[model samples]
Target chain A: MIIPAKSRLWSTVAVFAVAVGLTACQTTGGDAYRAPINAAKTQTADDPDKDSGAPTDVSGDSVARDDGDSGITGSIDDYRIEDLSPGERPDISSDEASVWMIADRAERRAANAGNAIKDPALNAYVSDMVCKIAGDYCDDIRVYIVRVPDFNATMSPNGMMSVYSGLLLRARNEAQLATVLSHEIGHYLRRHSYQRMKDTIDKTNGLAFFQVFTAALGVPVVGSIATIATVGSLASFGRDSEREADGYGVLLMARAGFSPHEAPKIWENLDAELGDTPRSRSFFYASHPAISERQTMLRALADEVPIAGGGPGRIGTEEYREALSPHWESLLADEVSKRDYERTERLFDALIADGFRAGAVYYQKGEMYRQRGDEGDEDLALAAYHAATQFIDAPPEVFRARGQIFQRRGLNVEARESYAEYIRRNPEATDRKMIEFVIGGLGS
Target chain B: MKKLVRIAALASVLALAAACQGYTLVKGGSPVEVGNAMKVSPERSWSKLTSGKYEIWTVDGPILQQILFASGVEDGEKLFPTDAQTPKTLPEFKKGMTELEITELYRDTLVQLGGTQFEIQEIAPKTIAGKQGFRFEFTFATKEGLQKNGIAEAVLAEDKLYFVAYTGAKLHYYPKNLPDAEQVMGSVEIL
Candidate 1:
């Protein structure tokens, strides 16, 4: 059942009370957030495969020892490809059972809320690709293509994968997309969420103990804020888990016959688009390893992996473009609406460099320049719009943009003609009445 | 004195509850001043809320439906608060902006307010407060996945902006309160 917000708050308070009660008897000081290593790591360590040479302790200590503060070291060469056979599910502990229940409830709520994109063809395409990487364990996974414009894909412990449209827009080819999907699948395979949840509970309990003590000392507000901060810190993956997932993902993509080189390229392109922004401080970035670190490790792993027939393997650029072509306008529109003109401009430049859809790229570039409206931006916007119209597949909004610019410049005759052309091209446009009104004013 | 104390206790409780819910009742048939430059006449009771420059009125709740007003917003001011460190990148209103530019400003405001997916359904010139202005219809979804439909009208005069907007959930709330919102919009006048 969906818990009401107030009830959920009270339940959390109850948990806090229990924790406080437990802490009242103890006097030892310890860091609360550090929980046990992931169950997969623990299990693998206990039952080390004699053939694989995988590390026994896949923990942060190992990463710290290898990489130090440079965030570069700890190669995935030690990780081995697990034999995931058909009809095999991980044995769940009681803790994992509880997490599974929570994940199930969340997945049900998300589906019921109409957030899951219901396009059968698109769903099949993405799921088929995921299954290719998943191998015999494919049936255990369910993919949801959500219409969010953030570069993220999440894997829930209950085998629910949400692929956001922003990832699709950023991914230049199928191999890059596969790389992300495989990484998320790696999280599921490693059972990171279950491990993370247990760690969060331990942290919360500790924070609650501290909170109660602080409240007793007459600083309830500060204590409450501390509790929130402790919880918020749990959202990002731990460094070791991220490293493990990255290594596993590279192996999985190579096994699926996708070019493993695309993995590093994705991060390289992302770093270029990000351009030294202090995103590493953000919670979203904090959860994962540094981009440069991941890129370096992925490149190393890709170089080590042997090609099936010594070929470049499948990039599937044309296939990926074709699958997403029908949704390009709406996706590009979402990207532009973000109003991050610099980032959007960089993205458009990359797309143009790829030479896939020049007309769409120019149209979006026009939008970015038009919306920014800096000194000399209007002329730049006009040139981009004109360039867009030179292609056969230029969006109908080009005429509207041209008309608005012309009208602003007091070129009434040109504005009228442009508006008329826009109206003629898009007869069923939602703003038909509005454009008509502009045309009438130009006549006067 | 005892009775008065009891009454005061009840009043405090009610106030706390109202604050927790994020709205206060604006009695029906009341004339509410919106911003510094405009007044609106409401035919029915509504919830009134304030966040930065936007004065919001709602029937069900702010999450379901809202009517927002902003008057005399100065140039160089943002429609919403932005991260102080990244001020240059955030969209801000400028003086002598054309109608299209103003519309873009509003679009950016909605985006900054966490509208993940946004589309302008319609835009055109309209009369607001007896002056030439612009009106637009739009649809968007919040980051939290709330689908909303909205309409807005704005006029630039006296080197300041006067604006009103209504937004509601696309499924039920928008259609239910759109007519009432339109009527409230019609009743706006520059004072």
Candidate 2:
């Protein structure tokens, strides 16, 4: 299948189109040099390749007439970037509906984090400020703030931007957060997700059918998308979508007046955080080129536009830590879930060093120990639980572990006391009845 | 034509089943006698689960089949604990069980491998290995965007509670393995 370039016309035509616009960027010795900032401004001006300049070579012309209340149209600035309408206007309100769906999902996930950690005040604070920074350039897209410790974010098909709490924690300053947020906002303004969804809808019918069939037929589809989307996102918006998202994100970050340089730095930090796993490891950052290449391009761009304003100095590292202190343990729970032992261990050590107070950390540490019941590490396992109990506000799990160990050693009274304490502390814990029974059995 | 093809497929499976009748042990060796009963142990030798990397005790039985045993003379973590909740929950493999602890025990035995999203669905009582048991199902959202369910049943038998947990991609899992799981459950006997 012929892959359409951003101009949406076949590459043969795009090559010619680029040859014609060759005056925009000066090529010296076969290497492209950063054009003056005005060149970008000039190239994006009233060029015929204006809004939605993707190729008109769209073969299947099934038009889903958008609910036509002239949906968020490109403002004068939007006209500067190529108009990114994938095909005919989809229902305008349909976009809103989707944004609400994703935002609702984010809210539900936030609810899952214990109330102590999930703070709407914090979510509102970040959302309000971050949107103000990026929205100055893109549309006022709705942002969903989730309470997770992983530094990740995704812009769905609609204008729903999900900002993981981990991203806030990891970012050193407001400019860094702005760089990341702008990249995601760029996804929406550039219409990457919708274009991808549309392009892949027909092609991925088989995989989608398989997934739907498996769900209907009662098969586990968990962690098996390798058989579905990974093979070829063609039916869904393939690698092209990711590359497009990255390019647009960088462009948006630059436009938003944040240091575009931080975009690549954010990626490099992510790579380091993840131990530089190769790009092909999982489809998470599917479109991200090598970290070096991204940094190279970002640096080139930064050299072109020396922002009049210097870096937005690192924002509240201490305040970010304090705001997130409550959920430090639960976020560690995510690390355990992802099986990033190296990262989980590091987070565990950091939390201990930082003197954060939370019952979840102790519980998670206890869990880590329990998971590590390797030979000769029984002592380590025991120690993890002991540390879990040292927390000022220990969860019932701490008592349960102590109780289980005591019972195993035939210390029935100690076990009974521990179990009873657990029962008293976590009256509503899922395993309450079970622990009570164990306590009763000890008495028997 | 399609109907004929399907019937032929079914007939072929039936024939294959008839061809492989009766119990078979690894290397076709004699069944190991434990207590008063003979049992098929996949732990006959080194496993391929983690051929040279790590070891996990993974036992693949017929659909619905349950394998029972301990790690060594020293008790290892419970394979399927009596109590396990979902989402914010964990596999009751036992206290102090490491990633290697569970993954290594059952090496390369699980087919149709998928992730477990431990969400507490429901907890109830059921019969497993002819003893009092707790049956808990862990619910996980699958990559295919479906919720996969795993039912783990643990029962105290032969001075030990055998834990059998079965998780499969829905369409071809529980239905196909339920009968085999039942047979394994029935065949279980203590020393």
Candidate 3:
């Protein structure tokens, strides 16, 4: 495929991102620059050029080294989360203090950001989840649920963590959400971002490696990836850092009474969403190399840590469903607005499979097709809308949409039924009079 | 390493070329046709980008303040350019979109275009282009962390869309230029 120069430049950066000699800053694609922002764990262990259809290589053997190791390390059991408290403060006039200052400023801005999900109920639920997984340091972290429509989360050194709306939409249950949260918190506890700042920068090659990303941020061409990487810790977080976070995430899940088994499923869903993007392959970024290996790795870690109560861990699918159900429509609306057909479809399919608010998820799925209006998408949209009406949570807009489609198909009777249903369901609709006029125009 | 350096150098040169897109001066009181349909008379000189169906005019840099005029948006076209080849996730303008959906498309388009912390403070019915339309007010922060406020007027007539929006840094630029933007848009004439 003849990729556009702008895209080609970014692919060049993502694929051939000038290597940070110490770590090879494996740049993945858009989603890699996003969630769990490691794309977090898997990089193809083999030559990147040889990597394609990278997800299926899930065998435990495809593991890439953390730093300079020859192979995957056995017994991640030795990893220790750093001790931290809510009362801790960075020393004044120190490098760590400067990072904290920048983060604090970013936090203040993020706190007031318009894109933040301001619903008190939703914010409280996410904060409680962070506390559950974070243990003693829970008080140290402040969570911001950004309304960005991508699967990513990041915690700045100053304890400010942003969980994107896309991640919430993608994660099927609470455990999956906890997985990402714990992973970010792990990065925080480990001081990974600080290490990256002091260790990665100042290194000549690393500086050179980051220059393109820095330039991309100001300019538009390749900046989308750089944009995510810059704010989301994409530029700084490395491979081993991801593995460690994954380990901590699993442990935290087990500790918080969530099934650690759900942890790796995040990657499985990500691979499904990303499909054949370069970020998924070894060609570039080599960010997400083997899916099953990481899954296996996560499973192994989960197996090692027993849930506290042995009650199969609190999967909490219902509670998670209930908490997010109220906000799914808005969250999915943001997700759908990205207009990535295949990925959005995958997300919908996952939501459907989860069976939580099927009406809401299917309604957005229909809207996706309706907005794209591609060939045969009309029929697909109609089918989706029809399916959505079967559930209680479908928005009133679906009937109006179906009414329009039916009217277009010259099925006035069906149109009237759909339109009437819309009016019945939404009596207070601002456009009620308009719908009534449209119905009158349709005739009896 | 050498091969990568060569590519990076090529990327820099291309980036420079891309960045140097010159702007033309739209002198005060000059009636300029925008988006091949609407004609507006600016009350004062402004800098306008000299390309594409989407027209943007600025007094200070665009990061601080700008006026955007989008006209003749037909079915299946997006309101703003979808920068980069990521996805068609940017909302598209379909024919027969209701005012509510249109406002949503504009808001979503802005967010997808990288404005964050967005909120529509108010949206109410009004008149634009001698037809029944709508106007709305919103506040958002740019990726660069500058807070901004915006006002827009739009109407969909005969399966085409005409929109005028002015956005500026919320503190001073937005309030200072509010009158000029209003007068400029107030002079809009659809051809």
Candidate 4:
């Protein structure tokens, strides 16, 4: 259930605030933007606006292009963050320390999270990919792969990151995943949430602070979806920061030797998935940068960043499929349960086009139509089910579906034949008795 | 100190705002009809809330403990209510659906309700209200990672669905209220 944006506005005052001492430094746009964590008091549980930074960019003069500390005179690409984490955090503010403690708490919670995908092989596979992308900072960031069926990722200020299972289902290739991870890493490198928190505390105090802080941070506009999970962009940072992070993530992907061109399509595909729904999907919409703007900016950045081998970057489609397909059924079930018809329709169509799991995808498409029971959806469901039965992996449920439709239409003979086939293919089916009873009623 | 106080005060305001929801009382030893389809006699008192097609009862609250009775769902109607604002549509109950499909519907409904994990421990035939129905036991977790456990009974009579489920936090609440839930479930009668 989506809480109204207005009511949830105050929830983002400060989920986790980090204070980093900035030093004048010079760097490349490809470099990450992490400042050391110091003492700060932030992160409130149920902070409505704290969790997600919507995908949309805030376009206006309110977004400060040059938000860097003093003497940081350079294009965003050339901006440098001296050290994201230093050995000693001596200058701890009570606020920052409290933030750290809570961040630690959030991390501990992630460690035992029930939705965690428990497959050692899948975990190892993803961890290895994250390791390759993380480089020297890999040790600081802890990754959690959760089974939430939404396209979201989150990086806590304490170096905790969560990758939702739906992200794996949505991303067609390794490169796409890399693009998002690199972006989240870019957020850590950039320290967007901390920066936003710092900006908030710098300006206000008292009840007015509580009232206006979330609004000023642009948290209210996109805070409604923070529970879905988030990373740098999901936390509702200023558009300037989000824009920079988006560019940085693509550049990082390009530098890491994954195909950066796949970056923009993440938003494009998500936009299609959202498909005129009133719900604001925070990761890529209704927040900071617009999808078209992000796509254009990301595409330009992708073109700007040069790859190492000078050949097109690696998409790693085969590697991604091999690593994730074992858990594909569970992931797809969660996806279907979401019941976002347009989103699943788009996703299934794309999967079919990619030849990822044509039979399963078709069958699921039929299931969606059949389950929804909207006008004329049954005919569409039957057609897809028929198409599904042609492939090797088509489930036995397809026959059951056909039988139900036929029985409802008074085609008892056809229904009986279909039920017989369903029972014939799977002798130990869980619903065998029920099917048999129905077939008994539809005698020859 | 000043900043800490400010943040704490803001939290208090939020808590006050959240406490607006009120619950009705279900008296002990009294037979109660829920959702216009079933009646049950509880051994203890509890708080209750009507959810249009169902009724939810709780001791500490829904997060800690809950008993759900969703009965009389007709063919082509949803087993659960839809949030008008969310674009998502819940799957409908159909005629001739089997116990296994019903189990799937429950699982999907939980998933849609933000349950992160569910593992069914058992599904077996059981007698309910003088008729053979299905009973299921399972463990689950919410999005926040809190573990939970539940026991449920379901019967399909005249193509109308009758279901009762009791769920609680796995730590202490489940064990604490399992007996209470069982008693209520045992007293269930189709009205």
Candidate 4 lDDT over residue span B65-119, tens digit each = 7787888888877655544322143457777776767877777667655565777
Tens-digit lDDT string for candidate 1 (A46-147)? 221111111222221211212234342545556654634455454666655645654564466457343456678888999999999988779988888877
Best by TM-score: 1
Candidate 1 Cα deviation (angstroms), residue A215: 21
Leading candidate by DockQ:
4
Q: Please, what are the lDDT tens digits per residue for candidate 4 over residues A191-283?
A: 665565445445433422342333222222232112112234444555566676676677677777898899888778877766765544443
User: lDDT of all the models against the reference?
Assistant: 0.66, 0.43, 0.67, 0.65
DockQ of each: 0.15, 0.05, 0.15, 0.25
| Segments in model 4 whose C-alpha atoms lie over 4 Å from true places | A1-90, A94-98, A207-231, A271-288, A309-311, A410-444, B1-37, B40-66, B74-101, B119-127, B170-187
Candidate 3 TM-score versus the reference: 0.72
Model 3: per-residue Cα lDDT over B91-180, one tens digit each: 788877766567777877777556666667766666676887777788877654567889988887889998888987888878888999
What lDDT tens digits, residue by residue, belong to model 2 across residues B104-133?
A: 222211211222234545445555445555
Models 1 onward score TM values of 0.74, 0.48, 0.72, 0.74
The CAPRI class of candidate 1 is: incorrect
Q: List the candidate 1 regions with Cα displacement exceeding 4 Å.
A: A1-77, A81-93, A112-118, A196-205, A208-235, A276-297, A303-312, B1-32, B50-53, B78-90, B96-101, B142-146
Global Cα lDDT for candidate 2? 0.43
